[model samples]
Structures are given as C-alpha cells and as structure tokens.
Target: MASSTSHQNSLPLPIFSGENYDFWSIKMKTYFMSQDLWDIVDKGFTTTENPSVEQLRQERKEKQRDANALYAIQQAVDDANFSRIMGASTAKEAWDWLKEEFQGTAKVRSIKLQTMRRELENLKMKDSEIIKDYYSRLKGVVNQLRAYGENISETRVVEKILISLTEKYDPVVTAIENSSDISQLSVTELIGSLEAFEKDWVAGMILH
Candidate 1:
C-alpha cells in the first residue's frame, strides 16, 4: 500500500536554475530592446559634459584620489599574485573585466568607457549594481544586502570603506614603508613619518 500526497513532488529538484535562466533570458531581451531608454531616462542624469570650474577642480582632485585607489588595488593584485583574465589598467576596469569573465548570468558583457566617466559613466549602478555583484559573491551574501540603491553607491558606502581604511591603516603602513626597522622608530617619529609618506603618494596620485 502507498500513501497519496496532495503535493506533487518528484525528487526535490532545484527550481533556482530554471528561474535564473528565465530571468537572464528576459533581462537580455529587455536590454537589447531598451535602445531609447538611456536617452530618455538620462535626461535627468549627472552628465560628464560641460563640467563647471569647481567641478573641473574637483575632477583633478578626484583623479589623484582615483589614482591612489588604482595603485592600492594594483598592489593588492601584485602582492596577492591573483591573475587577471583581461588586461585592465585600473582597479575599476580590472574588477569589471573580471566579473564579465567569471559571471555567467549578467546582462552586459562589455561596457563602454564613456559610460563610466561620471560615476563611472552612470554605470555606477545605484543599488542595482551592488545587488548584481552581491549575487556573484558567496551565495548567501546577497541576502544581507540593504534594500536601497544609493545605500550601495560609493558616495555613501565604498568611499566610507576607502576613507576608513586609509585613515586607520595609513599610520601603520606608513611606518612600515619608511622605517628601516619597525623596532627602531619612536612612536612620535613613526606618526610624523606616516604624514610625510603622503607627499610621495599625493605626488603619484594627485600631481602626476
């Protein structure tokens, strides 16, 4: 004798694969069809066109800061010996290229550089980008993400990560970079040396 069940269950099959495949097919179709979407929506966009004098000044400053970030990420890659799938010069580019190589279900493969000019060409992707990247991370991480798009932007989040890291670790990293022996430097001298190290860093990132 066999028991009858209301739930028609075969072996517990993974529905996620089916759902995700459907989502990708739909997303790609939508993207291909959305030719006029950017023109219409981006009427309100923060354009890279005709930046103000102050904006130009800030761009110079940001260029320096951006270079530092690029250097730091380059150092991370060099120190970690993590190989690259594509030859991207900057961290953002490298990260972007790597994602395309590694992730399968994403909508776009290659993005134009002009698109990243301001907020990386508005591809900066509000919260949606983070959600997309979050999905690519360890399976469970996306569940921890907050609901807002601005919440994931560098203006609020990634910059916080950068600033906190630079402030907190800059002192120790500076001491290590300058001192021949970490044991030899006095604490006060160590602090002073770290401040001076920024001259070299600023020159590399800001002026150059």
Candidate 2:
C-alpha cells in the first residue's frame, strides 16, 4: 500500500558537528518524527524469504524511505563525517555509525566525564566576569556532563554558583545561605536574586 503522505518536501536540517551531537540529535529526531520516517531510521526493515507480493512492495518502499532519510542526514554533515558513514547500507546503520563516531568508546567517554567533573568542582567565577557570563559558563559544563550521561542535580549547581562567585558577592551569598536551604534552592532562583543584587550594586556605584 502506498503511503498517504508525501515525503518529497522532507529536508534534513544540517549535518551535525561531533561536538554538538546532543543538539544535532534533537533536531534530527524532530525532523524524522515530522516526516513519519523515524521508524526506518531507528529500525531498518528486513526482507523475508518467499514473501508475498504486497510484502515485497512494502519492503521496497521502506528501503527507499530509509535511503532518502539517510541522504538528507548525509547532506547536512562535514566531509569527514560523510565519509565515515557513506558506506552504511541503511538509515539505522548510518545513525549507529554517527553515534559511535561522536560518542567514542565507554572508557573514552568515562574519561571525558571525569574531566568535566573535575572542571565543575574547581570552577570559580573570575573577578572580572559578570553574573550572566559566569552562569552561562557553569551551565555549559553542566550540560556537557549531562550529554555524557551523568545526572547533575539543581541543588548541586546552585551550591557551586554560591560558593564559586567572587568575594564582592559575599554578602548576597551569605544572605541566601542564612535565609534559604541551599540544597533545596534552584539555580534559576539563585541567579534571579543575584542578578537583582548585581543591578542594584552597579547602579549604586554609578551614582557614587
């Protein structure tokens, strides 16, 4: 049976660089789901021996769809990545190839995670850096840890922010520490209060 939907307009977003695999994976998943073709990409179709005519036709269509999706994905990536997965026979094969290429071996990923943990533990907001910039740097490290499969809690992030900020923020940090439970505080809430204090402090300095 022919598919009710047309896939002629289905276009892949772009090739994913190895470093931003998580973001690229999200876009690719959404694109596949939108085109009603994720199943082929996720699980390749197998042909059965002595199949009926209808079954053979269905299998052929499945292969064609998989090929199209694979091409779309291939178009968006760099030459090196393209060359790596160019020999894949199906969309699932290509997907697996990309995953392994970006994620590397378990031992390598473990080492990467350990390094990120050390960076997070030793993170300190530079004296010249603003609150927003510091927060972004902190979040980047946290997100990388997550991409590597470690689970970081909101409280842990909040604690890091409070302790690592510069001495000028000491009064605000002390206030927050005394008034609120650091373990229960969200990073969002902590940032909001600190940013407000920052604005006021800046305004006071300008007036002086």
Task: Give the best candidate by lDDT.
Answer: 2
lDDT of 2 by residue, 152-176 (tens): 9998899889889999899999999
Taking all chains together, each candidate's TM-score versus the true structure is 0.26, 0.76
Clash pairs, candidate 1, are 115-121, 116-120, 116-121, 117-121, 127-149
Clashes of each: 5, 2
For model 2, state the Cα shift of residue 134 in Å: 0.7
lDDT of 1 at 12: 25
Tens-digit lDDT track of model 1 for 38-139: 222112123257899988876665554334434433333332224552255444554344335444224432132222223322222233233224223312
